[model samples]
Target chain A: MIRVDENPEDPQTVNELIEILSIQLNEPVMKSTARLMIIISLALNKKLTFTDLLEITSLGKGSLSNHLDKLKEGGLINIKTVFSGMGPRVLIEITREGMLAYENYSKILKKLLSH
Target chain B: MKETPMDLSDHLKKVGKEVVRLDFYLLKRAFGVYYATWAAAIFTLTILSYISGITEQSDTYLTLYGLLDIGVIIVAVDYTRIVFRKAHMLSRLESDLQMSKSFKTIGNNVNIGILIVLIVMFAIIGTNIFPGDLNSLLTFIILWIVDLYVYMVTRISFGKVQPEVILAVGTFGFSNTASCLEFLLTGNSVYSFPLWLVTVIGWSISSLYSFYKAGEIHSTEIGESGSRFS
Candidate 1:
């Protein structure tokens, strides 16, 4: 295969290189709509609750609940439950790992523009 | 107690949209890192060859270079397979979305770190900055093992064991061992085969053991979270 630097500015070559890079950096968690929105919101807010996530994203109860579970399992978000007067309410926060992934994703977006 | 049909449909549509957006974000990130690394590797190799005058035009050198090129191509193909597999898993989660948040977050972070390390390795090797010595080989092996371990831990924690994760671990193991053997065959005495071989074997064994342990943890918590959601 021709090396990348040989024709770095060639549009076709650049496109191929971009294609390969896209494959390597793609994250499974980032592909879910609910997860992405929650991540963006969490990044903006630093922390939120399940109800807050639902209200912000306008996701239904089942969809929000299911996506939140997946995000939690993936370590993208953290849930801290506290007992209030009525019942236990959970506060969701993006973990350090999640923030890193978000940052990485943001970096990728910047690259695409430069390319 | 009951959700209207329109409500359910609207909810599913929203979920689908979220999945698409996430896919776009991931694809962009993966491609960006990959291209930058490729460009840097090629540039470094070209510069090193020019400086060292190491381009011995012998038949033996040409044959060995061809073999190395083939090996790299194989690795690239395997990497593509991994990318596709992860993409497929994400698509499935769009519908099921049953995976754990912690696992996904951890997996993404690990993936990014590994890619960065890989780019660095490519640059270092291409530049011939670090001779193929025992210390360098040991560092490569240690990093490979760590990457595999992190991958396995993420998989087990997520409760969704995609074949891609196992494939990645296996591929990294095979490549690391093969590279070491290649060094040995080249008569490089910088590394002791006995010690490096043992380290590789130990890491491989421990990685598998941890994988099983992770599986157990996942199974235990499978349905436990469902009740909380309800």
Candidate 2:
């Protein structure tokens, strides 16, 4: 929290605040629009597979995998990989941490911007 | 801070709503398919009615409906196929979700009660329509009851509220309302045939759309999560 005496409305203060908020976001949740989309999409639907996400997000192979790795590393989601007749299937499920982070992020964003 | 901060509550609200919307993605798509099927069904019925000489109605309108219905059903199917062929993942997701426990949930006691009530209401209307012909009335009632079950099953195939299902239900409601009015007015000449035409059209579209989508979904390979995206 920035001190009121420090002029919360200052550009520097706002930039710092933005940075702070960005840092607080879940590892898989921040900066990239695709990451946020992934989290939001997972939060909305409890579970999704690679193909499902591919169809929904229209994200390419490398980009989706990169975001998934970050999310997976941050303990935001669980990625399960296995084989099927069509080839490989990757299922992505949002963890409780990821869900809470997403909800909190949405709330905080609304709060920050609502003024 | 100088300029008034843009109010984004509405935008936030929209984003929040998008989550809900995404949740119903497959359902909405399924609805388009439903409309296509309903058109085909109505066309078929009109042709059959015309052939049997069941009513003194204009054969031209009925024949026109058949042609239009067939055309629309074919187009909707092709559109669905085109968009969804590469996106087989969507079809799989829809089918898997539909086959899940939610589909079975509708078969419980409460729905059955509602089903019974609907059956009774339609039966009264059917009986009134056929007048002294008890056999025809019975047949009409039985057929409607079967259709009601189909309607319910189709509606719940993917946890309800597929756009197609809603349209189909609305169509049914329209026809029934017309039937009730017809019963009050004269109750003798199948005055609700027009409404029935609308009803079958709606169902045929709903049915074909749902069927193909579900069919596509079922075609996907299902097993352990694959290494590719799992």
Candidate 3:
């Protein structure tokens, strides 16, 4: 029942860390690592266009499309469309689950790397 | 199975740098447009002074302006292309980043302030410039139209912008307006220390409006490499 914030070296912290490690290591969610990075990056922004992702990731259209579709299907991200005078623009934003997954992934990654 | 050739840490650093580069590139582009537009304005005024016979006796001024025009035109074309093709992009990026100090209204505010300066200029100098009262009024109207043209061109090249673009553009607007106001204030008809004080007050009004909002001044960040020229 120890809060992770309240105590650093409590046995509960180790148990919770181990549980987090196992969930991250074994879960099908965010297994690709690239997808994890996508979520993490999106977490840092309010929203990103397909073009933004393309520039930041340097991934080709087809490859980026495949990843985006998978993320959308997994409910980790949402692809919304808006119409401008020029044309329709697609905006990608991370969902709550995506944000939580990223936060968890980052915490675990930081802890593991620090060790 | 998807490829996992690289580590997340490496990807983070690599992506991080690319975004940083893009941010700096955009900041530089915005600043470039602001400056180029200023140069264009100078060229315009030189043409005006020459046409109006104000600088008729000043060959040196003409030659200097002509040389400066050459450089300004060259620089302006590149900056114009970058800015016109990419209006509002900088604001969008800052919005995406959820930057708290984003000065979204500064561009519009600055524009309004400059228009005020033009209005004051018309009030003070309209009679001398146009000679006849009716001609003066007509000239004032033309001035409004021309100012709008210049302002819109500058706006399209760099408006609804945020972060350093807003700061740079807004500062340019104030300085341009202030200097122009100073010319009017220091005109022989009303030239005096009191008017100079009014000019300083005029500058403070525009500058304080632009920089003091957004809760805290991020002009400090304007110098950050994120604030660095491209």
Task: Please give, for residues B12-94, the per-residue lDDT of candidate 3 as tens digits.
Answer: 33433334334333334344444446444444544544453443557777687667656765565555455432433334333
Provide DockQ values for all models, in the order shown.
0.03, 0.05, 0.03
**B39-66 per-residue lDDT for model 1 (tens digits):** 2333333233333344456677657655
Which candidate, 2 or 3, would have the higher lDDT against the true structure?
2
**Per-candidate local distance difference test:** 0.48, 0.53, 0.47
Taken in order, the candidates have interface RMSDs of 15.5, 12.4, 11.1
Once model 3 is optimally superposed onto the true structure by TM-score, how far is the C-alpha of residue A6 displaced, in angstroms? Answer: 11
- Pairs of residues at least 3 apart in sequence or in different chains that clash in candidate 3: none
Clashes of 3: 0
Worst 10 residues of 2 chain B by lDDT: B221-230
Model 1 ranges off by over 4 Å: A1-115, B1-10, B13-64, B67-101, B134-139, B142-158, B161-230
What are the clash counts of all predictions, listed in order?
A: 31, 21, 0
Query: Which of candidates 1 and 2 is the stronger one according to DockQ?
Result: 2
Per-model fnat list: 0.02, 0.05, 0.02
Highest lDDT: give the candidate number: 2
Candidate 2 residue-pair clash tally: 21
TM-score of chain A of each: 0.67, 0.68, 0.69
